[model samples]
Target chain A: MSRLAIHGRDLLLDRSARGPSWLVPSLEVSRGERIALCGPSGSGKSTLLSAFAGRLAARRGSLQVEGCELVGASEAVRRAHRLATMGQALQDAEMISYLSTVDNVLLPLRLAGRPVGAAQRARAHDLLARLGLSDRQHSRPSQLSHGERARVAIARALIAAPPLLLIDEPTASLDPASREAALDLLFSAEGTVVFATHDPGLIARVDRAFDASIWREP
Target chain B: MIVWHAAALACKGLAATPIRAVVVVFGLALAMGLPGMTVRTASHIEAVMVERAVRTPVLIAPRGSPFEVTLASLYFRGEAEPRVPFFVAAQAVTRGYGSAVPVLVGYRASGHPLVGTSADYFEARGLRPVQGRLPAVLGEVVVGAGLAAQAGIAVGDRLRSDRVRPYDLGTSQPVELRVVGVLGWSASPDDEVVHADLLTLRAIEGILHAHEPAGSEAAPGLGASVFLPVDLSPETLDRVHAHGALEELPVTAVLVFPPDDRRRDQALGDWADHPELQAVQPERVVSVLVELLVRVRDLLLAWSMIVSGCTLALIALVLALWRRLRERELALLRTLGASRSWIALLVAIEAGLLLGVALSLAAGFAWVAPVLLLGALG
Candidate 1:
C-alpha cells in the first residue's frame, strides 16, 4: 500500500480575525501508521482532521500530504490534490438522499470523468463485498442499518482507492460489534489511515495514539 | 453519453426530492399565468376596436386624435361626437369620394349602447333587418342581438329613453320608444348596438328647442340643426351653404363611395390630404393594435427571461452549496479518481436540461393561450 504523509508545523485556526483558537498548534504523522487522535471534548482534535482534509485554512503552518507541500497552494491545486489522493468518510455520512447506493458508489467515477466500464463496476462490487454488503448494491443510504451504513460509507471512501484515507469517528453510531467490524475494515484496508476518536476499544486496535490536548486555544 | 447521464441523474435526484420539484413547478406556473391574463384583457379591447373599423371609412371631425374619432364612431366606447358641419359628409357623397352615412350616438340603455344612424349603415355592410321595420317614426327603434340579450328587448317592446334637460348630461329623449325590429345575428361587430334614423336623433334635439328659453323679439327656431345623410357631387356639396354657427349640426363621420374609378382614387388620395376628412385604413388601425399586442407579448417575454435567469441563478447557488454539504458524496466521487471539471460540468448540464424542460412548457402555454381567450370572449 502507498503511504500518505501529513506534516503540519505551527498551524493557527480562527473562526474570526482578532481572537481565534489554535486548531492545531503543531502536528506530524509520517506514512504507514493507523493513528488515533484522542482528547476530551472541544480540544481541536476534529479541526486537525479537517485541516488534513483541506476543508479549512490553517493560519500558520506548512502542510505536506504525500510529499506535496500545500502551505500556499492555490485552491485549484489543493482540489486536484484532494481529488487524486485523499479519501474522506464524513461523520454524518453525507449520502445523497436521492441517488441509490450503486449510483452513489459510481459517482466518483462519473466525477473523475473516467469511463465506468464493466471492470469498474465489478471492482466496486468487489469492494462492497469486502464489507459483507453485496446485497445493498441498490439500497439507498436511508434504508440501510447502522452497521450496513458504516460498511457502505467505508466502501464509498475506499472506492477510488486513495493513498491517504481520513475518517472521523466512524464508530459513533455503531454498536460494539459493528464498531469492531468497521475498525477491522478500516485498518485492514490498504493506505495510510488517520482516524480520530476517543473510543478506548478502537484506540487499542490502532498502531499509534496521539494525545491531542497539547494544542493551545489562541 | 454525458448529457444522457446528467439528465438521468437530474431526473432521479429531482424525483427523490419531490417537494422541491412541486415548489418549482408551482412557481413557474404562477409566473406564466399572471402575464397571460393581462394580455387577454388587452386583446378584448382590441377586438372591440376591430369591429367598429369595418363600418366607417373616413371621419370628418374637428382636429383631434384619430383614436378619439375612431373610438367615438366605431366602438362608441368613448366620446364619439365630432364637431364638424353636417355638409362635410354630404360633400363627400356628392363629390363621388364615397357614399355618406350620418352617425349620432351618445346614449345608453341599461348599460347597453343605443346609436342613432341611418339605413345606409346596413346598406354598407349588406345587413337586411330579419324582423319588423327600420326606425321610421320618432318613437321607433331597432335593437341588436347582444343588446337584446342584455336588455331583454324584443320586437314591439316599448323601451323608455331616459330624458335629459337642455345642456344636461342625460340622454336626449324622455319618450318611451317602441322597438319595431330586432336585427338578425351577424356574428360580427354590429351585434351590440341599437340603431335608429338620424332624423329620430334630430327630432329628439327638436324637443330640446322647446325647452330653450323663449325670449321676446327672437326668432323661434333652434340654431343650425340636423345631422343629414347627404348625397351630391363634390362640386355640388361644396356649393351648399353652411349655417354661421360651426358647432351645430356636426356629422360624426361620412362613409363615401365614388362613382368613377379615376375619381375614386383621386378622391381617396385627395381626401387623405383634405383638412375636413381623416381617411384611414381600418386594417392599418387594426394592424397598429396588433403591433401593440406584440410589444406587450415581447415585454412579457423579457420579464419571463428575467424570472428564468433568477430561477436558474438561485438553483445553481443552491445546488452548489448542496454539493458542498454532501462532502461525503463528493469525496466518494473524488476517491473514484474523478476530475473536478467533470463534476462541475455534470452539474451545469443538469441545470441546462431542466431549463429546456421549462422552456418547452412555456412555449406550449403560449400556443394554447390565444385559442382559449377567443373561446372565452366569443
Candidate 2:
C-alpha cells in the first residue's frame, strides 16, 4: 500500500520578481511521520507550511498531498482537498475568541459541512480530555491560559483525525514544562506532522528534520 | 439546514456583544415605527372627522372660523369657539327645513364632556339606550357607553359635573346629575360624552335656577345664589326658570340634518344674511380641513422618509464597523475552510435577523399606536 502524505519537486515560495523567495528542490512525507522543517526566523519555513496547506499557489512545482495535485489546482479543488486531508494548529492563529473550547474543536466539521451529532460531540470531548482540557472545554479562549489555549488548538486540529497536520511554532511562547506537554499531546495525534519550529529540543524529538535554510535563494 | 446553522452562528456572534445588538434593534424599530404610527393616527383622525362631518348636513354657529365651529359641534372640542343663540336652531326647526338639534357643549361631568342636547339630538345621532331609557326628566342624563365604562358609571348613578372654575366665587357650583341610561356604542364622538337636556345643563351653568320663594323677586344673573336643587322634585322642576328669554341663550352650535339637498340649500341661504350666525356645510369644511391635514401629513411623511433613510444609513455604518471588527474572526473561519460565500451568508443572516425583528416591532407598534392616540384625543 502506497501511504504517501506529501510530495513536492521544485516547490517555490512567494514567487515575486523583486522580493525574497526560496525553492525546495524535492520533498516527501509519509503518513504517520513526524518531520520538522527546521530553520531560522526568515528561512521560509512558515511559507512552506502555507504552501503545503494550499493557502497560496506555488510559482512552479509538482506538489501533491495524499495523491491530490495542489500546485496548479483551482481554489475550490484546493479547498476541498485541504479540508479533507489536512488540519492546522498554528500558534495562536486558530483560537477564535468567540467560540468555546469544544466549539472551536468542532469548527472544522462545521466548515466541512458535516453534522456535529452526538458521536461527533463525544469524540470532541474525548479528544479534549486526552489533551488534558476536559475541565476547560466550555471556556472561552480569553478565559484560557496560554498553555491551555495551545493544547486546545492541537485538539481542534486532531478532532477530524485528518491524515496530515500542519503546525507553525506550536511551542513558541511556553515555559519548558508547557512546551513538553503541548509537544506530547501533538505527537500523539494519529497523522503525519510537518511542523515549522525553532526549538532545538523539539527538533531533536521529531523523527526527522529538514533544514529549510539550505533552500534559500541566496 | 445549512442556512439555519449559519443563522445560529450569526446569533451566537451577535450575542457576544448584546448591547450593540439591542441598540441597533431598538434604533431601527423607533425609526421605522414613528412615521408609520403618525401616519396611521392622522389617517384615523381624518376618517373620524370626515365621517361625522359627512353625516351632519348643515351647522349653524356664531360667526367665526367654520373649522372651529365644526370641531366644537362634532368633536366637542374648541371650548373657546363662539356660541350661536338658541333661536337660530329653533327657527331652523320651526321653518320645516329639516331637523335641527342644538348642542350646548364645553361642560364636563367626571372629566367627560357634558353634551346638552334634546331627544332629537339622540335620534339624529342614531344613539339608542343600551341599559335604560333615554333621558326624559330634568337633572337626568344618558352617558356614552365608553364614558360609562371608563368612569364606572351605570344607570341610576349620580354623576356631578366638574365645576368650570371652582376658584371663582361668581361661577355656579357643580350640579349632581342622575344617569338615566347608557347610550350604545356608535364608534363616534358621541360615545364619549354625557348627554342631557339643554335646560338641565343651563341650570348647572347658573343661567336657570329655582325661582326665589314667592315674591323674593328674580335676582340679576341668578348667580350662584341658588345652587341647583340636588333632587328635582316636581315642584322644584316647575320653579326652575331663566330670567331672560330662552331663545337668546347660547348653544355652541346647531347640527342640522336636512332631509334633502333642497332644504340643505335653503338652510345655507337662510343663515347667509344673518347678522350674528353663519351656516356651513360641514362636509365641505371638513374636506378643506382634511386636505390641509393631508398636505401636512405628506410633508411629515417625506420628512420621516428622510429620517428613516438616515436611520438605515446609520444601521449600515454600525454593521460595517462591526463586520470590520470581526474581520479577524471571519478570517479564522476562512482558514477553517469556509468559502467566501459562507462568510458572506453568515453576515447577511445576522443583519437580516436584525431587520426582520425591527420590522415586526414597528408593525405591531404602528397597528396599536393609532387607537391609543384616538382614544386619548377623545
lDDT of each: 0.64, 0.83
- Residue-level lDDT of model 2, residues A1-218, one tens digit each, is 45878889998777467877778889989889999998888888888887888887888888888788898998778877888888888766557777788888988887777788899999999887876777998999999987788777777888888989998888886677667777887798788998899899999989999988898888
Given candidate 1, what's the lDDT at residue A136?
85
Share of reference contacts found in each model: 0.33, 0.35
Residue B311: error of model 2 in Å? Answer: 2.1
Tens-digit lDDT track for model 1 on B52-71?
Answer: 55444455545556666655
Model 2 Cα lDDT, one tens digit per residue, B47-80: 9889999899999988867877788789887674
Return the TM-score for chain B, candidate 2. 0.83
Structure candidate 2, residue pairs in collision:
none
